[model samples]
Target chain A: MSASLRKFIITRILLTIPMVLILITLVFIIMRILPGDPIRSQLGPRVTEAQADVLRERLGLNRPLIVQYGDFLVEMITFDFGNALTQGERPIKDELAEKLPATIELSIPAVIFMAVLGVWSGAYAAKNRKKPVDYIFRLLSIAVYSIPIFVMGLLFQILFSVRLPVFPLAGRMDTVMLVSFDSPTNFYVIDAIITGNWPALGSALAHLALPAFTLGLALTGVFVRLTRVNMIEMLQSDFITAGRARGIPERRLVYKHALRNTFIPILTLIGLQFAALMAGAVLTETTFSWPGIGRYLVERIELRDYTAVQSTIGVFAMFVAGISLIMDILYAFIDPRIRY
Target chain B: MNDTSPLVQIRDLSVTYKTRLGDTSAVDKVSFDIRHGEILGLVGESGCGKSTLGKALLRMIMPPGRISAGQILFNGEDILTFDDKRLRDYRGRQASMIFQDPMTSLNPVQTVEQHLVEAIQVHEAQTQTPDATGRIKTLLERLGIMQSRLASYPHQLSGGMRQRVMIGLGLVLNAGLIIADEATTSLDVIVEAKLVDQLREIRDEFGVSILAITHNIALVAEMADRVAVMYAGNLVELGEVSRIFDRPLHPYTQGLLASVPTTEINERKELYKMPGEPPNLARPPSGCRFHPRCPAAMSICSRHRPGLNEAAPGHWVHCWLYQDHPEKEEKTLKVAA
Candidate 1:
């Protein structure tokens, strides 16, 4: 509401535009520098130089670096990413359309799992600080945080999918469907329910549960530690004391005074963690063979699909920047002090 | 003024903090009564347990700083025996506290109206008061904040304004006894003077007993009706304001008085500083805590501690200098008063 806050929001929004462009440009340049030729790789090792050159020319790779970059930038501005060299006439948008939903399906559920479990654990640990429960949660967080996500994903795959055999090993759904549905919202859960496929909806949730939980386990420690540290510090603040002095209920003080103050920092951390989650999804997606962007990027990278690699990374970077910007704007709403 | 029942009766109250090294006494057997409608000044040096005593009275000591032993009777009911819920119920309804840091004492994320409304709702939840919002707005206006500030956050206010908001928060609860622990220590002198004057006026208007805790003797002199001086962890002296300034009897009280520079001097003069740092509470001196730096220390002063005893009709002193020594009893106690 203040003039300074208005100026600050405008400045933050303006600053984000250049940041997005620079990050995308950097990803674009770095992809070119990495050792690989998309056209040559697509032609395979047995192809002749003549064939590779023809393919390269056809794909616009024969142009000068600046001209190629300029053309790509212009195309990107129009939101019409050209066909993938490897896919041979398949547009990048089509690949994204198939892959983005799967990635969101995995990541969004994982984030929700992390937020609920992690925040509760953190709050509990802070409330029972110095006790056995606190120590146990602290050690659990440390162990979870120390283990590599890929290793944990493999372990979960072995235990939950292969050994126990309670859930599907890989893929979004089974072949023989008791009920069929159109992908209206691109999310199976919503689309199945919309099309009146109750069994399909149930199956979809069951399929999502394991991978989501696995990834959630990987992420929970981060939120736990972040919220724990912030909440502990917030508990000592004079505002909490004032709340107590005002005779506000202990539960109210804990929720209102303590947790709310910790939100700004927690929000900033959550935004950073979401970006990390996108990067980490490559491993989870590949391990599970879930056909998400992570696996798409990995498979493309193996075949040296440079344009696909660069564009995918660029899109993810843009997503990260956009979400963070939105969060920074929301920061003003969460904490009035952040308006400026 | 004729009410003889002490609003707050603290007896043999002692607080100790359990540090990693050892237990340190923050308030040692410091006891005093706050009479109704009277402003009692709890004055001492920075580490002299004035704030500790005030907090102990409210049963608000934080972790590790436990009230080792005490009886703080508010309205003849000992508050230390109350459970958490009961204590909370009694906290703002019967007593409330205003902290030194107004900026931090308020939730910066909340609006002024939200803060006041919370306090009002906490204490007056059962009251059928349709004028609650109006009353809050009027209180803020009286505290010099405009109607627009009701919707403003703590960060939006100036330091003086934040302090006024904190004061308004303490009073809005309508507690019988208000403990202001160095409430104006964070403000400019002029603002502090204005606020304290405003606080005194509010006190007079509402007939609320106030425990005004500050290290500034001058501020205490201006606002408090009676003064209690603490040293280390002891309540060394208590008397009427006039007696405290005009006839301080205790050696520690005299040292505190000497340390303060006279404002009337106008020209800059070398102020008398306390001779040494306060003794460690974990291992205080054998005789008197002030004996190490006391210029008037005698052989007996190093061997035996003194007790708080009546030196005059209303003045109390805690030093061996006014002891019943046949050689100097009459003259020493008489001259000091």
Candidate 2:
């Protein structure tokens, strides 16, 4: 495996840890939310010592094997793990607050950029099928799709960062820019725009362009190939011909009619690919050295801080779930053939 | 610019599909004319190229399929020579086509209103005018669709409603020629009958020429003013709908009528089922394409193709059974004897 991809699987593991933790939490919630609330009643203030010991001894007997997990979901929420990233007694929230936003600031545009460009080029390729432009696009999509993500990131870093010197080589921003940057919410770009800090926005965006594009470009070929295949199928459909017969322009028939018809399947793929990218960001983050949750979770694991680890995983679960839920809702909106 | 010359005259038109193996002649040298304000039913079995002939009139044949030879004259102008811009104006303005399978014909994502308005916008120059909206609502209502259904997508509508929506799209631009190509085959019998009435209503109200193409003889009988029967890309018989249906001259047409299961006790005797599958267009029979399946096949049927002979007033048949023909072959008479 490529070094960057090896780390990506590791990051995927990091994201998946949250999923496993969430499953455990779901069991806890199910136990807690049970019709009679048996566990809560068992640990009430007046319980006898014998009963307590019996309950403790069984380790949740009468429970399925799957339900015997620890419950520190509350502690994970409070988040008081100290000195994980820094020298002495610094709160883990402080580290997370800074790193998580950097990852997100880089990710949002990457996903949007890749999806738009991918669909546009894919539709273009389908339109020009068997032509020189179509062949070139098909070739480029395959080439781009097969190359590993980290390798492309490194190559781009060498070209854009080292040789060309147009962007920052590593980190979210320059030391000079970082010193003056104030981010309470920790989302640098959003914070910059809201504050009307044009220079800070420029600095953040300038630093962002390379890694975001590299991250986006890596996954773009997948969208292109998918959209092209579906668009070609849709273009031949009766409605497309119907549109043509109605004197609807060929351009509208393609981009508006045929493209929208392909969206139901493509939206599903987008939802899946988005979740995959969000959870599988370890390598891209490592190559660009953007301090995100993947690195933090690794450090917490090294220190054997179970509370920090579980909580971070819980948060990651929510982010991925939130994105997928939004996508599915968007699916209902895009395709009238189905309801939520 | 001849008003009396027929709204559209298709002369020697042929559409050939270029497959990897060879060219398949889908519509071969078929000549016909659709006059103003008439529902001309084109009936044939599957693969007879009736649909290809309909698409050919509008120059709507896609790639791999080309109009190899012929002229489609609309208002005495050759549509085959029209450029892209002219073709666009010609379509949906001069002519439009309603398709088979309404389930797959209307864009699922667009509402009925959007479908109608955009179809008009292609020629109307303005977008979303109250004038267009009012016309669409009125037309949909006239087609028996409720005003509320106008906002609904195709999937929300029944098969019959969707077909009506398709008709609305074709009519919104007021095209001179409307090709209903197997337009109601996917619907149920009741829905098909209802749509047939609506089609006749459309012709009566708009006075626009319609070329109704279908394989269902009963449907063509109900809806068309005149019927043209095709067999293996050949026009075998054509006349007034009653004349053609009552006394079909060609053997293929007779077989087609004879095969239809009727409910009348007297007409419920042994049905004539056609013996063979449709001939492969890439390698058709030497003389008559239908000769192998033709129950009344003769030596001349396998040796020399028959030309059309008018058997009765306004009734034509392409068959060797009819004597008076203009063929130059001298040996056909001896063989017939």
Candidate 3:
């Protein structure tokens, strides 16, 4: 890389450090401010006030709020997020390992689906602007976007799962297979394939289908609309007109030439959407009873498991921040015009 | 000079557009022929419809715009009659165009070689097998582009070089007639002159013809063999370059010539620029459209439109001064007034 590019990357990384800290601090503060006692939620109604106070002291929850926050920050820097409150014995990292992958598996397909279908439909709409195809796509996108994710999730489950037994609903996999593998990675699909458990892999995907489709449909609609609008505007740019005048094939003109230029802003939208999905997949996960982080957050929040909630929020926040950074770097690489 | 028919013979062509506002005439009864190995200059102001005329010849007019009436006869066949398949074959094969802006004309994601190769592959599919890499390098070199620059995008190249690349794409197709629509207008004056010179070299060396559309009179004076001046979508004057410049007779043509700023005015005045803007084509003035702006406007001009008649040897002008018998003699005397 040139000196300028190196300087740019360095600058971006440095800037992101404070942004990450600020995010973590905010998550910590917000979770603390909400009325919830991690000790009481852990001990349950059987515990006396004395037992609750002892548990609070043991967990360092009795310290002043600023001191507790400072300690939490120091621990987080070393990647030690202490222990889970409700379970008492389990590490927060272990809980995250179980829940994070499930959420990711569910969300990844939806994201990929949104990107491919959204970009394609958007490009088509742009190419056929003001025509019937453009109008139909526009209407479809708006219709899909107008529906809330939870409503769409419920609707898809009703129509596809309950009404018709065409798909298996809920759970990561069926109980029938004695499919246990050496955990090379935490992801079940990868582990299943590694252990030569085809049935297990098939079952996993089967269970994944409804949630992916529902979640994907909801987000893809918005993506398609956003991308289509952006691509349509870009199509009218002078460069596109010039390409047409040069006798470029219509397909190449729309896809390779026009769409690629539309990517910078579109990718940014996709990144922010992925961040939102990490937190916002609650409705989809709950509807499907999928064991994902989004559903886990809702369950913990309802029971008022403050430690689990804070740690989970912190982890999710970090994931989003990390993805956004990667996207920023990618943007700089793809279009040199977008230097920091 | 060797025996070969003219490359393009645009016959009594007219074009109209159905805009949201109303129907507007873009090209009206304009007729001209471009011969082989000669550069024909189409000159006029921005709204004079020179670019529209160029697009009409190519049959590339988009929707809301249509050829209301015209015959663009390329090699004795009217292009307007061609269906989609035949038109596709004709475009980029027999004739191609280089647009004004080089930046937007190119697709950003694609490499330079990919852009040129696609154009070549499309039109030259029937002939020799496409050696994509070889042809691209050869064409780029012919247009004076460096070999290293082949991998660079349009944004990477200078404006002048990008136009050259655009020109190179046209050349790769071996097109007979190249319509360069204000092709050099976006470049610096020096670069514009250089590119035009390079274009002249290409025409001379390759036996290709060019329809160079521009608003700059000096460019036409330097580069064109024959010049046609358009006013409000109508061909007001057509002649050899020397005849049109030395003895311009049409009032609009006269006004356009006088408008060119020259230091030789000797502090006489700022310049003899014609007063008034181009008339609105949607509701253009009656009779001659130039009458409102014509310094020598007469009552006859506003009542009856003049026809282009050969006022001098091989020169055509649509002005009342060149119309009729004894009145022509009387008008010539009155012209001095």
Candidate 4:
């Protein structure tokens, strides 16, 4: 990479620190103001005030506000959430390491599916313009985009899992495969492959199918519409006309030349839609019983585990910042005019 | 092909656009011939269909606008009837175009060398050796872009350099006819002058015919061996440049030339500006399209359309004033009598 790109990356990473910090701080404040005390919520009313006070002191809830805030920040920096006050008093970080990877694994294939299928179909539709294929794609995109993700996940489960038995209804993998293979990375697909166990890999992928598809298919419409509009506008550009004048095959003009130019804006949209994808993941993980961060976050929120909630949000903020940074660096590589 | 025979004969070609109002005929029954090795300047005001006519030669007009009639015969082959396979072989290999606004003509992300090489490989990719850069390097050098700049993207190059790269793209295919549609309209006068000289050198050295289309009358005079003037989708006057300059027959042609600012230094005289805009092509005048704007419009000009007549041996004019209509004249005389 050039010196300028290296400098851009460094500055971009530096800027994310405060962004994540602010997001975490807001969560901390909201959790405090929300209508319930953590200790009261976790312990029963049968427990006396003296017993509650002792547990509060143990959990550092009795400390001064500024001191508690300082300790919270320090703990966030170290990524050590001590222990969950509710969920069996499990260590928050230990639980997080497993759940975060599952969310990322589901999201990786979901993103790839949305980008590839959406971009390709959009370009195809633009090339066909007023034809029947174009109109069909236009209608299909609207139809696909309007259906809520949770509804789609339920539908997929009924049609593919319950009725046809083509896939597992929920979760990341079957218990049989989970116990058979040693999941070192907590990513079943990776562990299955490394173990050279093809059946385990197949089972893991089969279990992943419904949730990933529902998650990905819900977002494909946005990419399709974006790529379609951009491709149509790009096709009218002078370079495309010039390319046609040179007798380039219409296939190459629409798919290769015009599509490449449209990607800078598409990359920006991809980065923005990532947050929406994560929001959908919460519903997806709940409907499918996938053991991911979205489900974990929901469980913690229900239990009013304040420490777990804010830490979970902090990790999300970091991931979002990292993705946006990657997108900016990608823009510099795609468009030379943006190198500065 | 014989030198005397026209290289490309455009016979009664028309291009129309389907608007909500009606079909707008941009190029109307236009017929002309570009001879081998001749630089024909096609001059007109904006929206007068000069660029449309240029694109028609290459069949580059997009949808909603299409060739409604006429045949384009290139080297005796009618390009209008060519299938996808033949059309691909014909473009860039036989004829190509250099568009206006070089800034937008080349892909922004693509390098200069990549533009030229793609034009060649589209038709002849199999025969292309690894050293395809051999021809590309030589062409860039001739266009005044250095070998080092070959890897540079369009944004890195200056405006003049970009235009030259466009020119190189057109020439790299060794095409016989180059339709330069206002190719230098965006350039500064100095760069335009240099490209003009290089274009002339290009014609003389390569023996390639050119249709230099622009609104700049002065540039047309400087470079065109023959000149064709279009007014409101009508080819009003066409002849040798010297003849048209010395004695323009059509009133619209005369009006166009008189509007050009010369270095004569006439005392405090304002330049002659034409009276009306080019008509809305969808609903042009009933007869001659130029009648509303013509300085010497006759009473019959609105009622009767005039054909392009050979007023002199090698000069053509489309006006009732020059082409005598004895029968129409008698009727007009009786009205006066």
Candidate 5:
């Protein structure tokens, strides 16, 4: 690599430091300012007001606001998230370490599905532009993009699980199989495969199918439209016309020349969409009752678990910033016009 | 030179654009020939259908623009009858096209080496050319491009270099003919002149014919052996470059020549401007397409469209002024002398 490119990457990395800091500080403040007392919400009517006060004092909620804010920021830097108020005071870090991988496992496959299907259908639509095939693909993309994620998830469950019985309805694995399978990665599918647990793998994948599809299908529309519109524009470009004039076959012109040029914009969209998918996973996890960070976040938020919420939001912000940085580096590699 | 058979013959060709508003006649009943190993310059103002005519020769007209009527004969075979496969083979091997803007004519993501190699490999899949790299090196060298620039992307190259690469792409298949549709229009004056000189060298070295299309008459004078002037989708005059420049028969041609400033005449003569804009092709003027703009317009010019008449030994003009009239013939002879 050239010195300039290395410098560009280092600059981008340095820039992310301030971005992450701002994001963590904002989430910290937002969690604290929101109305609701964690002890009251967790204990509900079962605990008396005096007992709740005692609990709040023990949890450092009785401290001055500045002191609590400082403590929160310091704990974040050290990756310590204290404990969940509702889950028997289980350490938030341990819950996240166990659940984050499950979210990733589902998201990774959904993204793969979204990228592959979206790009393929998009290219097909562009090549057949102005024809019936193009119209059908375009309408289908619009339909998928407009549908609500949870609604789509529920629909899939009804069709594929309850009525057809082709797949399981909810959760990460069957109850009987869950006990026998040793989770090495906390990601049931990966752990199942690593331990030679084919039955567990089958069960985990069966349960994963509907929700992943729901998430993947919801995001596929954007990629399809992005690729198709960009591809059509690329096909009309002087280079593509020149390629055709050179007697390069139509397929090669569309795929090799037009598609390659269209990728930079598509890649930018994918990066933005990946961040969106991470957020959308919250609703998807809730619908399927899958044990992932998004579902865990919802549970913590309902119980006003401020520490857990702050940490989760911080982790999400970091993921988004990191992905965007990697995308910038990739842009430089793919298109030579971009430089430091 | 006159004895050589024409390589491509266009007979009464017409290309029309079927827009929703109306059908616009871009190339109306045009006829000409590009003979073997000769450069035929097609010169006209913008939107005069010169580029459409060039594209018509290769049957490369896309939607909204179609060759509504015409026959393009290549070696006695009408290319209009060719299928997709035959047209594909004919395009890069028999003839190819170079566009105007070199900056946008090349894929920004592809290197020059890849562009040239793809052009070659697309046509000759089972080639026995053992040294493909060497072949590309020679091709680039012939176009005055450096070997090191082969790995560079289009954005990395200068405009002149990119145009040279475009020229290299045109000649990579050893095509017999190249249609340069305003290829040098986007270059600076010096770069344009250099490219024209290189085109002349390529013609002589490779023995390939060219159809150089442009609105720049000066460019045609420098690069073309023969020139055809088009106005409002009509071929106004066709002749040897010297005759067309010296003794233009059509009034529109005369007007075009007068409008150009020449350094030879040191007396600062006012540049003559053609009085009217080009007629819209959707509803062109009656009789002669140039009649409304013709300086020497007459009643006959508006009533009858004159066919091409041979006024001098290899010079053809479509004008009523050249028709057989004793007095008019004497007047034309005096003008020619």
Candidate 6:
């Protein structure tokens, strides 16, 4: 590596610190300002005011605002998001560790599907611009983009589940097959494959298919449009013309020469969309009854679990920040034009 | 030099661009031949279709720009008839082009090594030579580019170095002919000189034919053995460089020569400027496209389009001034009647 690249990496990493801080701080402030009483909401109206006060004291909610804020920062720094206020004081860390990977499992396949299908169709459309096939793809992408994810999920459920009876309608796996595999990573699909539990793997994938497809299809339009536009621009570039003059095959010219140049912008979009996917997962997960962090977040928000909400949003902010950093590093690796 | 059998023969070639407005004849019935082991400098003002003609030789014209009528015979085979596969094989192996802008011509994401290796591997995929790197090293060295620059991306190199790399790419296949379309137009004076010297050396050393397209007459005078002057999509003059410089037959050629600022004249003389812009190709002038702007235009010049006729030994011009016409008076009387 060059000195400039080293400097660039250092700068990107340093910039993330303030970005992550601001995100978490905003979440902290928003949780406080929102109309909610975690202790009362959890204890119910029948509980005595005295009992509520004792519960608040135990959970550090009785402390002064400054002391609580400082403690929250310190605990966050230490990666110890203390017990949930609504879930019988279960540690938020443990809950997240169990749920986050399930969310990732859903997101990974969805993102892969989005990228592959999106880029392929986009390139095809660009290559066949002004043709009937291109027109059809354009219209379909627009339709997919306009529809809401939950609506699409519900519709897909009806068409592929109720009507055709092909896939499981909801949840992470069949209840009967859930205990058959050892989930070493808490990501049932990978764990199922690792333990040679093919039935569990099939069950997990079948349950995941509709929701992931719904999420993937929802975001696929953006990639398709982005890649199509970028690919067209790159194909018109002089380098692509030069590549053609060099006798490179048309396919290689499109994919390697034109598409490779389009990657930096496409990668940027993917990074942003990945963050958006995590946010969208809330709707998808809720609709499907999938036991993921998104569903956990919605449940906590409903029950007025302030600490759980804060910790979950904090984790999301960190994930987004980390992804942006990784993308920056990747840009440096792929295009030598970028430097510190 | 095998002058009898020209390496590439372009016969009555015309290229038209299908714009929304209408069809514009960018290149109109242009014909010329490039001899083996010789430099043919194609000089004209911008938009004279010189660059289009160069691209036409390789059939590299992009869409909306089509060869409406032409026969580009490369070694007796009409290249215009070639399909995509054959065209791909023909380009970069038998002939290659060097673009004018080095900055935009090279892929920013690709290293110099990647560009050179791809140029080689695309044509010679069946060849099992691990010495691809060795060949690239020698080619760059010959072009005055250092071996260390191979790993560097195009953005890392200077403009002149990049131009050299472009030339290196053109030469990597050991092609029989190279069409340099204003290849040195973007370089500085000194860099241009160096590159022109390198082109000459490559021609002499490798016996590669070159068709240098440019607007610079002085560079052509220095480098090209023969020159073809184009005007408004027509080949106005073709002759030995020395003869064309000494006794220019066409009025446009004379104007071009007189307009060039030479150090021989110590006193400052007013630069001779051509009066009008090139005619729109959609509706070109009635006869000679240059007649409207020509200093020596005649009534017949507007009515009759002059064909390229030999004015001297191995010299051709498309102007009526050189034609002996006994029928001129009779034709004029007939037009009046």
TM-scores of the candidates, chain A only: 0.92, 0.75, 0.92, 0.95, 0.95, 0.95
lDDT string for model 1 (B1-337, tens) is 2478999999989999998769998898877799998999999888889888877776789888999997999989999999988898778778888899987988978988888888888667764444677888777766677888888899888778888887787777667898898999999888888888888887887778999999989999999999999888988899999999987877778777877877667766666666778898888887777778776777677777777788887777787776665433332332211
Query: What TM-score does structure 1 among the candidates reach?
Result: 0.92
Candidate 4 clashes between residue pairs 3 or more apart in a chain or in different chains: none
Candidate 4 residue lDDT tens string, B257-315? 87788797865667778887879989989889988877677777888889989999889
Q: How does model 5 score by TM-score? A: 0.96
In DockQ terms, which candidate is top? 5
Model 1 interface RMSD, one decimal? 1.2
lDDT of 5 at B302: 72
Write candidate 4's Cα lDDT for A266-325 as tens digits: 999899878888898899999999999999999888767877888888888888888999
Q: State which docking tier applies to candidate 1.
A: medium
Better of 1 and 5 by DockQ: 5
CA error at residue B211 for candidate 1, angstroms = 0.6
Summarize candidate 3's per-residue lDDT along B1-337 as a digit string, tens digits: 3336677888788888887668888887888788998898999998888999998887878878888886888888899999876777777777888888887787766667777877777666653445767877877777889999988877888999888888887788788888899999999999999998999999988778999999999899999888999999989998999998887877777778877877675667655666788887887788878889876767777777778788887688877767863323343322211
Candidate 4 residues lying further than 4 Å off, grouped into runs, are B330-337
Q: Which pairs in model 1 have colliding backbones?
A: none
Write the residue-wise lDDT of candidate 5 on A197-226 in tens digits.
Answer: 898989999988988999999999999999
TM-score of chain A of 1: 0.92
A87 Cα displacement, candidate 1 (Å):
3.5
Tens-digit lDDT string for candidate 6 (A1-340) = 8797788778877888788788878877877788867887888889988998999998889988888778778878899998898977799999999999989989989999999999999998888888999889999999999999899999999999999999998999988777555787999988888888888988998998998998899999988999999898889899888878878888998888888888899899989997989988998999899899999999998877878988898888888878887887888667778765
DockQ measured for candidate 5? 0.78
- C-alpha DockQ for predicted model 2: 0.65
lDDT (tens digit, per residue) of candidate 2 on A30-115? 44344532322346657786776675454333454344333254445455433332233256667767777877777788888888
Q: Across residues A1-340, which tens digit of lDDT does each residue of candidate 1 receive?
A: 7788678768877786687678768867877777877875677789888988888888888889988778767766676677777866478888888788888988889988888888878877887788999899999998888888888878887898889988887767665762355675677877788888888888788788877887888888888888888888888889888778768887788777788888887788778888878877887887777788999998887767766776777678777877787778788789877646
Using lDDT as the measure, name the better of candidate 4 and candidate 6: 6
lDDT by residue (B1-337, candidate 5, tens digit) is 3337788899999999997769999999999889888899999999999999999988889988899998998877899999988888888888889999999999998899888888888888875444566788988888889989989999999888898898888888888789999899899999889989999999998888999999999999999999999998999899999999988888888888888887967786688888889988998899888988776676767777888889999999998887853323233322211
